[model samples]
Target: AVALGVKFLDAQRKELPQGGAALADLVTLDMSGLDPRLGTVKIEVACDVQNLLCGPEGASAVYGPQKGANLEDISIMDSALNNFGEVLSRVANTNLLELVGGGAAGGLGAGLVGFLGAELRPGTQMILDITGADEKIKQADLVITGEGRTDFQTAYGKVPVGVAALAQKYSVPVLCISGDVEGSPDFLADLGVATCFSVAEGPTTLEEAFLKADEQLERAAWRILTVWKLAEECQLKKLRHS
Candidate 1:
């Protein structure tokens, strides 16, 4: 936005015209680039998410909490994004508001596609294809995937969920193990994740959590494997009886 002479006023609603980016009254944009558009340049932007530009699953509502933004902040910011999206669509002749992956990096995906005519592809899937992940997932009976954190945003195409989507095609189960879990991921079951687990044994301070992360993860993985083995043995016993 700086390059385009647009600026965001991230201030409280009560604070006024001095601090509102998404609120239409306090917003202004004039991004007619001095340079001509780069004609015939094929740009492929990789996104790890599939969030659209607006709505509940969009950027502000989904990611604002992680950045310390409260409900009020999210409401205001989302409104502002509406204004930005309007301008981008008009200027670029591209309808980016509801485009998939448009919410990546809080609408950076929309900006790139709107202004530069870029393509947004799932970053994880692109990497998987290049590394032949389909074959590996097809062969695995169960897939264990993880990330530093898992939350509602994970459904919008985080690594664990992305892997789960792939596993579903082959009827394989997926277990999501994370450092921590939050945000009511009830939909994960429908996405082929059998369950989600947290490595933390109990509550701890941030510093302590980071310090003991490796130790906790190792123990958690061991416990998970043990349970898996027990389940496998039980299945075998049932098979013998039948």
Candidate 2:
């Protein structure tokens, strides 16, 4: 499935402004001229399922602020998303302006669905399916997964939780090693994680942590693996005695 980025697509639209590229300029576009090949393939997108194409809770208004957008920028970005959505909708003969999750990734979700015959799914699910994670998990004795940081947010369709779900299907233990860890260990355990470890050994600035990331990660992995080996040996001894 082709997941198009709204900003990237808008910047590429034939319409251009004098100062720079602007999404609002594309409002006058002809939808009938959209790519014809888009109809032939099934497109799926990954994003937050609750956001709409345009408005207060929409992509631009909600996410744009964090991207360094001032009030003026928010208005322009919102207008651009609306323009893109409307044009794509007209060309594809499908209305997606208020479609759920349409605002994800700056309205890319809506644009692809409206213009490219795409559907939307959780990003984790999409990645797992694409990577054949289920098949891979079934063959492994233990699964190790990590990210820059892990927290309760991990349970909300994040990578580690997604991997844990697959590993759990085969009753395999899952271990998470990350740059930083938040929430309680029990929280991760409830999500099917056997345990979690952080590369950060003590309080340190982000710059220091980044510089030592490689060394810290290698040391953390070695320690976990060593401990796991001992645990396995103990289990084996118990089984033999029983």
Q: lDDT of each prediction vs. the true structure?
A: 0.80, 0.75
Candidate 1, poorest ten consecutive residues by summed lDDT: 7-16
Q: How far is 29's C-alpha from truth in model 2 (Å)?
A: 6.8
Supply the global lDDT for candidate 1.
0.80
Most accurate candidate by TM-score: 1
* Candidate 1 residue spans exceeding 4 A from truth: 4-40, 183-185
Clashing pairs in 1: 22-80
lDDT (Cα, tens digit) per residue for candidate 1, span 1-242: 45544443323423124433535543334445424545467889889999887789878888788889999888988887777787678777888897899988988998788777889988888888988999999999789989888887787778887899899999998998898898655678988788888989998987999999999999988999999999999999999999
For this target, which candidate reaches the highest lDDT against the unseen true structure?
Answer: 1
Backbone steric clashes in candidate 1, count: 1
